[model samples]
Target: MTITSPSSEAPDWPQCAHEADGRRCRGRPVEPYAACLAHIGVDRRAGHLAALEPGAGLDLRGTPFTRDLLTELLAALTDPATGRHRLGPADFEEAEFSGDAQFARVDFTGDVSFDGAAFGGGAYFTGARFEADLGFVGATVARNVWLDGVECGGGVCFNKTRIDGELRLETGTITKSAVFRGLVVGGDATFSGIEFIEPAVFMETEINGTAWFDGALFRSDVRFDGARIAGKAWFDGAEFHHDARFDSATLSEDVSFNGTRFVEGAAFPGATIGGDVEFGGNEIGGDVTFRKATFQRTTVLGPLVFPRLLDLSDAEFQSAVTIEAAVGTLHCRRTRWSSTAALRLRHAEVDVSDAVLQFPVSIAGRSHPFVADGRELEVPELSDAPVRVASLRGADAAHLVLTDVDLTGCQFVETVHLDQLRLDGRCPLASPPPGLRRIGRRPVRWTRRRTLAEEHHWRAERQGADGWTRAPGNTDVWGPAALAPVYRQLRKALEDGKDEPGAADFYYGEMEMRRLDPDTPPGERALLALYWAASGYGLRATRALGWLLLAVVATVLAMMLWGLPQDDPEPVSTGTVTGSRVTMTTDKPDPVNPQGSYGSRLSSERFEKSLRVVINSVVFRSSGQELTTAGTYVEMASRVAEPALLGLAVLAVRSRVKR
Candidate 1:
């Protein structure tokens, strides 16, 4: 067939346009192109490559071909090797594979475009170099695709492409933007160690197998928005120099971001994770958000350093959620907690001044509470559901809002953010987790103790106290003005729950704080002091018992010392004297009978007589023969006090314990 340039003015035969070494190429031109075969044109290279096959396989490097050569190229590449050298890879460089054609690899040196191409075989482009743009729009690869160690001077794209097998693009360098929107991968895909100088987009993509981006570096923004991963996804050791996003994505299996670094920001808003998600040991420099996202399984974030902020507003945790280390502002307003355990925060500090730290978590499951601070104390009416415990331990938080929280089966360790906290439902009582040791590492403690000194220290610090100053009788750090409201709120919560004993505990705290309050009225302070000393505000039954025991012992000792009280000496007539040396005389006949009444309520010790006097003094009963005197009245008051203490103890104990 006659070959000619695609021009109406050309004759049936057209000469080549390229010349080398001062001689022109005598080859005919290919249609629709200016250059002829053997002169930097497609037809010459295509026809030549179609005819020549090495002893083993096709070994045509630097051979230019056109879209018509796509099928023949695949056939030649798939053919079995015959000779040893022929088994080598088919090479193409400075060749035009044309638009709408795709291959795996070559030491490419010129522009290449596979726009709107289809491939029935693998797409392995390992160690390829491109001086110009490498496009793959509207392409399809039926088998595995590999693009390792590629270096591109221009931009790259895989837009609207579909692949039936794995696709790897690791260890590549693209000077310009790389786009992969609407792409689909059937098998495992990797983009590790890649450097995208400009932005990289993977929006609206779908991956059916595992996706690995380990050690990948993005110099510009990278986005995976609206993508879906049906299998596991890993981003280990990846570094995003610019903002990285996975917003609105769906992950069906476990995803990990171990040792990853985000220089700008990372976002996953409105995303859904069906399996576990962990970002252990990651350093996120900018704000990281998971707003309105849903986690179906365990979500673990630890050793993560977010320098700016962390926003989790309205996020839902169906399972357990843990934050081990976060050093930035934590915005967790209006979060929904559906997990059967409390939210756990360990070794995290959220001290940002302008952040929204309200923990208005809406509890969902019956097994879990809204939040917990690893300290445990048992209370009544606890749930019997298997312990699904969650806790936030070793964290310093401020301006917190903990409304409608239930800490029935939860514990907190080193968490000190209860001050100025907003509340709503069952005020999160610091009671022991329910059903001890049944679930979630919740501990059960039966003994009560004084408030911890460190806890108070932190409280004082938050209250703007410069130094530690214990209350008059208690070790509370916050003065009455700062802590009285908290105590009252807690008391009201317990009272609303009809837990009088619990309310009394808080009431005791309130009175204790008020008693030491410098601003309190002097009369009120005195009254509060008296109340505390007397009944410990109706909470310290044990203290009242101690006082009763002390009173009983002390009264007994006093009775022994006083011996017996004798009726005022019987009146006897005597003479008066004029001076200091004067003397008087009296008759001795009235005391002649020893068995007669002595007019003194004295009893002997043999029949426990002294014991009788002691018992009378303790019971506040008169021993008879008492000629009224101020001394006798004091004894009577002492006798009444011991029994009152005993009664107080009994009442206090009965109110709390179900006998």
Candidate 2:
């Protein structure tokens, strides 16, 4: 192991040709020996170990060291003041350790490189501090690797490394960026309480054991895309100052992100979670997306405060999921829920368009804070914040329940099981425009009715109507024929809930659609038109009453002009007939029609008679007064028409006030 000059007779400098693990050693040979000190025989290694001094730089690249040999080298570099190995600049690149490598509490004042190194047994660097960058690129550890409490002033890289046993970086701090891309850990890996000052990349990394990242701080962006964790992954209390991407990652066991904070945004698109998941008590400053992700077990995704959007579009949940978020927008379009789910939100605009709901799902508006996982989460300061639903279009709503959710802009046209949807609390829908609006040349006053967003879009597009704003990107406008059934189903739902009064408006809407539907039969459409014009389909009491009053006035005027006699005739003895049988016969004069100068028929006496006759006709009663031939027909027509109008008015009143 002694250093000596090469022979002057040699044509070129000789290189060590020792081979191990199919790789030939390329270290410079010792002058007295054919191989470097690391690859030299054990009997000849004493001189190299004796030559090493504390704080010395060691270069063992491309060398192979046994456990005993490595110990002797480290012992030679041990500092007397601290009784610990103090290395200036250690380069172990392409080095192979045959047994356990112990470097615990070792201090490397200068840069350290273990790149392409292979450790046959456990490698310990616990409590070690590197003043500069620490590289483990392409390194292989056959057993556990302990890096707990290690501090690195510069960036740390474990890129493309493989650890067959446990890996611990707990309580470690990296001042610069940390790269773990394509790293593989076969046993449990702990990164708890680690502080990463710069961006951390873990793309395509695979951990077969439990992954712990609790209390980790990532000052810059962090990525774990395409990574696979076979066991549980705990990221509780972790903070990410910048964006965090976990796209296409796979977690086989329970994963927790509780109490985590993402200052920028986080994404998990196409990720798969095979076990239970906990995402509560999170503070996300920007948008968070889990689009197309799959959750195989129960998941609790809330008690979160999201300042921006939370997109779960195209996601699938195989088990029950509970979400308690105060997000700005929750997009769940095309999401599939195989089991029950609950959404307790505040100040969120939820869109569940085209979602597949296989079990009961409840979307409720929560005013108070949420208590989850033994933690009390605070809500936003906006006390009057409302949870509104943007759309239910193309959703199967048979098992859907809504509680205190605002549906003012919800589109229900393509929703399934609308009649079975349960609406609890004050689930408000959009109301039609107030007051009268001119449609074409005629003044049309829309009835105050709860309507769907699709209906608004349809009407707005059809008539260029005001007071209805179309939803963004919503180009599908349902026609009256399609909207008619939606309104009818909703009306039935309200009626079943014992909210007949609330159902009245929906019934009115249904009738309106039927009247306007071009596909409706001509005879049925005409009847519906008449029904609406006269009494608003038995839902507008004022309209019915107005028509009734007009009918009464017309009947009174007709009776005075032509349906009343000018005067009454007195009885007189006329003539004898058939001798004794007709000795004294009584004769009554026929009532005569009113003569010309019709204004005279408007006398107070005649008016009194006309008023009495019209009043009798309203009640389907005869006045028993003499009348002209035309007056007979007028009274008969009034008897049939006036009573029917009065009945319609009564029906309208009942419909509005029914319990």
Candidate 3:
């Protein structure tokens, strides 16, 4: 066949153009050199070209294809009697058109292919399955490209097909490996339900819109690390082998790896998936990192098990996240994790913050259990991450409620600060493993008890004046007394008060005394000894007047000096006589003065002076009137008990004048 370049002067070709156009030829004779407009010009239809019979391997080696020639060749191939199906570089190349080109089912026996075809318009291969190893290896389509429900055998290669519009490879099957490496799509590229029996490559593709690989199965690695996507990239239900990577790529919209099965491994390290990463049910094999990648939205990775590490270091989540379950450790070191909702580190190994550590009910499966071993979670290398305590001013932590939770062998690294942590579990001791090294190597067992015991004691001390006092008076008097001597002595050393031991000390002393004499009646012995010790007198005085003996002596001293004296003859000094030898006078009998005031002023002054001398001398001589006076005074009080009781009754009645 004589292959020629289509000319502008030539009539329109009927093979390549749409048959819907009137330019379509009704009949076409097989001619090597045809002048019919149906087989000549750029406007010709591809469906009108006559089928050429195969002849000793026909070749159109140097023939360049115009839009008209391509249309004609395509039309000729549609005819059965034409006996020709194979076409090559002799046909379409650099084809230009204003509309889409549809090539429904048409058989080509030989290697009929478009090695470097460039379609200015959209191209469609819907249901027009290729039987042989079809090749459109370096095709470029200006508009959208569709190959829906098409089948290709012996490996199809569109290694560098650049599509200006959306590229759809829906429900297609590539029996062998399909190569689309370095392909560029200006719009979205979808490969939904497309089966690749061997492997597929979409590596290094630039997608202007979403690049969907939903429901596509890859028997090998499906890499997208170097692929640039302006919109969201979805791989929901896509399987990976060997490994897959989106590392170092920029995603402008949300990126999903949801339900993707990573049988071997996967990596998205340093890839910014500007929106949320919904890995709701993904199975990850190897280590994954969003390390230093910024997520502008929530990154939800619910109920996942990564066999190795999953580092989210320095990643920031703009919204809330639900990480209900995680099998491996999630390192969120130095990350700015803020969420309006409660940040759940439930059951997941969370390594962040310092201040205090609190486990959640979700971790315990009931209420939050206080595990003493949690303090070991603190890794000093991450000291910069301080726990954020929201405030404790008006908000009461007591109001926060919780449920029962288990605390079986949980480790809290450092202090886990929480806003409000409620514990309803039993007090459990810290039991470290045989091989694990304790943090700081602090006396783990002793320190655990000491810490908890100190806290408990401190709180109890605040609740009352006693430390861990079960009831108001549950402890022995001596128990408080032991503290009293020390505290009182300290307080007395500070204040200007008597150096005498406090009353609390007396009670404590009484307890010690009773302990020495256990056979004694406890109440009687304690009360009796306490009274005497408190009174600073002998036991006799203590039993007779209790503590009231001190009051009696004070009253007596006041009355003697301040009350009226007898107005009869005054007795002379017995030590001195009336003679010049200075003998002591025994008595002097004097009649009452007319004014009944003889020696009254002198006597009163002498009496006052004498009483002062006596009182001072007595108190100073008898341990400051704390011994003899105390006993005598208490005995005298017992003697006037009846009259005193009667007087007290009258006073009590009189004191109730208002009532």
**TM-score, every prediction:** 0.55, 0.88, 0.48
- Order the numbered candidates by TM-score, best leading: 2, 1, 3
Candidate 1 lDDT: 0.57
Model 3 lDDT per residue over 1-659, tens place? 22222233323332232233444322221233343333344433232243343221223322334455545556554435653343332333323333566665544333434444556677777775555565665667778888888776656666677788999888877777777767788899898877777767666678899988888777765566666788887888887765676676777787777677777766666666666566555666677777766566654544344445567666656555544333345565655544422333323344442211121212222112112223212222322322222111122222222223222222221222212334333423222223323324332221111011122232244423222322223321223223323223322321222322222222333343343344667786677565344432221222334334444444345323332233435567666445667655576554332234434434555355434433443433221222233334433443454234334434333322312
Ranking by lDDT: 2, 1, 3
Model 2 misplaced stretches (Cα beyond 4 Å): 1-32, 38-44, 80-83, 372-383, 417-420, 436-444, 470-474, 492-500, 517-527, 560-562, 573-584, 594-611, 657-659
Following a full C-alpha superposition, what root-mean-square deviation does model 1 have from the true structure?
A: 13.9
lDDT by residue (tens digit), candidate 1, 1-659 = 11111222422345557666664433344444546533544565576556644322232222234555555545543434421111222222222333333444443444565544445566667766665677777666667778888888878888888788999888989988999999899998898888888999988889999988888888999999999998998988889999898889998888888778888878999998877766665666678888888888855644344445667676777775654433334555455555433334322223222222334332222223222134221212222322222233322233333433344322233344533233443434443222333213434322242232332443344443333322334333434565565566555655654666656666665676688678999999998887677777656698888887777655544443343333324646588778776667775332111122433233444125335554566564665423224335546766678677877888878767732
TM-score of 2: 0.88
Greater lDDT among 2 and 3 belongs to 2
Q: Is candidate 1 or candidate 2 better by lDDT?
A: 2
Q: Which candidate is the best by TM-score?
A: 2
True-structure RMSD, every candidate: 13.9, 5.0, 19.5
Off by over 4 Å in 3: 1-71, 78-98, 106-116, 131-138, 283-287, 299-308, 314-325, 333-346, 351-659
